[model samples]
Target: MDAQLKHGLLEVCVLTALYKEDSYGYRIIKDTSPFIKISESTLYPILRRLESGNYLSVYSVEHNGRLRKYYKITDLGKKKIEEFLDGWDEVMNIHNYIVTETRRNENE
Candidate 1:
């Protein structure tokens, strides 16, 4: 995938994960693991970017004598997700065209 596009998608994915409830880093990674395997290295930078963008808010809570930072999606972040979803049909159209072209070439 294109790096820039992948970055934006990942940002939206993270936002969706926090849509229902606030989550900590480890839990977010674990929850999203089924679809994407994100390591701590990748997640923290994304978190920082989201925080800086005001897409989410971060707060530290005491967990087992340590501070665990949790992320909550903001209205702007929710709108970002909605915006991405609004364009889903175009992406599906492109995907279908690529598949059809690839299969047509194979049958030639």
Candidate 2:
């Protein structure tokens, strides 16, 4: 995927993952892997950005005597996701236009 496209999609994906449940960095990577390729390098900055944006909140829990940082979606995050979903229709429409237009021109 293009870097720019992936950047935005990844942010939404991260938010959605937190929406499902609060999770730490590695867990977020694991959860998102089924849908999108996410690694520590890719995920950390996104997490930081979301936390900074107030879309996510972070807290640390001691697990196995280690501190694990967990992320939870905020009200702002939910609102943002709704906005993304609402805007998705336009994206799908543009995709449909490209696909059908390409096919039509090809058949001609």
TM-scores for candidates 1 onward, in order: 0.89, 0.94
The true-structure Cα RMSD of candidate 1 reads: 1.7
lDDT of each residue in 15-100, candidate 2, tens digit only: 99889789889888888899999988889888889999999999999999999999999999999999999999999999999999
The best candidate by TM-score is 2
What are the root-mean-square deviations of the candidates from the true structure over C-alphas?
1.7, 1.0
Task: Write candidate 1's Cα lDDT for 1-108 as tens digits.
Answer: 677777777888889899999999989988888877678898889999999999999999999999989999999999989999999999999999999999999999
Most accurate candidate by lDDT = 2
Report how far residue 93 has shifted in candidate 2, in Å: 0.7
List per-prediction Cα lDDT, in the order shown: 0.90, 0.93
